[model samples]
Target: MFMRGKCIGCGCCTSRCNADALLYTGEEMDADKVLDEVFKDILFYRKTGGMTLSGGEPLMQYDFSLKLLKGAKEKGVHTAIETSGYYPGKLYEIAKYTDLWLYDVKIFDESEHIKYTGVSNKLIMENLKYLNATGSEIILRCPIIPGINLTDEHFEKIAELSASVSSVKKVQFMPYHPLGTEKMKSLGREQKYENCEFLSRDAILPYLEKIKDKTDKILEIM
Candidate 1:
């Protein structure tokens, strides 16, 4: 489930949930509301052992997340978080309650990350290392933007970083897509990367294979 404020109110979740499990509440949700909704599928989740916490950034609501994770653990549901590692010491606190972490590493270079995401990589990288040190199961997610970070240099840098991290379970290379351009227009913000193109799956395969070939770690395309 996603929190409200940073959400831009995107109805993407409702549109994507084919199971009809997701609905727009049209309101800011507290821990109580989130738990009530999740518990609806407890029987099914207990059988499959699946549950995830994703967001614009989950760590933004630290206490709420802590409660959710604790509750999920008590209910025997596997907990996971999808986040861009920008928060301070929250990683350590959340690690205690979380089962797995989906860490998004946008760009290796600081300036490029700032240009694209309006944030620097300093804190993000630091948080990743901290999570690794804490012995958490972490997956590295990198969005392969054609003009931005899809070059050979960036790929090599990512390989090197991933190789050094012992806690990383897999490295995923995701191709850029224009899926958010229209939303930018609706929100009245200029889409700086609108003209950017998505690389074909064929074109991205070799680069991904090369990165995976460099190390024995699992390489995934997402």
Candidate 2:
């Protein structure tokens, strides 16, 4: 019923919810407070292991994210961010504090990108180039969705970026899976890829071979 748009945006449902499952997932935390939580895993994040800020788009909270990254850096922890490269000047402002960028390029073509993601890829492409200019280490993260973007052209475009961009030190493939279908169903929402199967590492084997033939950059399947 929720996914069918039956529930209005009012707070009635949340106020009445007994399970406490749909409450806000975020909390107010200053950089220090967040760091307190992070340091709990200090032993586990010994050497190359450190904080990786993922999102809903971390740049949405630019000031907090910057402060958090700054605090982590001061403590000598390697910092990485998984981002869509959508935020304009903010990325450059925080680039120095970010040790690595798990930058996403969902689709290479602007039209196709807008068709699938409902946004222009122009800013994303620009931000990526700008980030590259900053000499930041980047691992190009590409999602290989079976029916959506599991195509030769998409892989080729990714290969092109690795070959042309000096900062793109490697390529990482994030294959699509139906793992979220159960959650979507639980919420009474329709799953977009309901018919799609989990993408095994072997599903991208041929594309990997194709990309390998195009660039010498390191490749990882995640």
- The candidate that wins on TM-score is 2
TM-score of each: 0.84, 0.85
After TM-score superposition, the amount by which residue 8's alpha carbon in candidate 2 deviates from its true location, in angstroms, is: 8.3
For candidate 2, the TM-score is 0.85
lDDT of 1: 0.82
TM-score: model 1 vs. ground truth: 0.84
Q: On residues 1-222, what C-alpha lDDT tens digit does candidate 1 reach at each position?
A: 444447776778798999988677667878878888888988888765656888888899888888999888888888889999889765667798787888898788788788888988899988888888988788888888888877888888878888889888888888888888887876568688887997776778878766776765688787
lDDT of 2: 0.85
Candidate 1, position 39, lDDT: 86
Q: Model 2, range 97-210, lDDT digits (tens) per residue?
A: 998999998987788788777789999988888888888899999888888888888888888888888899999999997778888887776566777777889989888888
lDDT of 2 at 27: 68
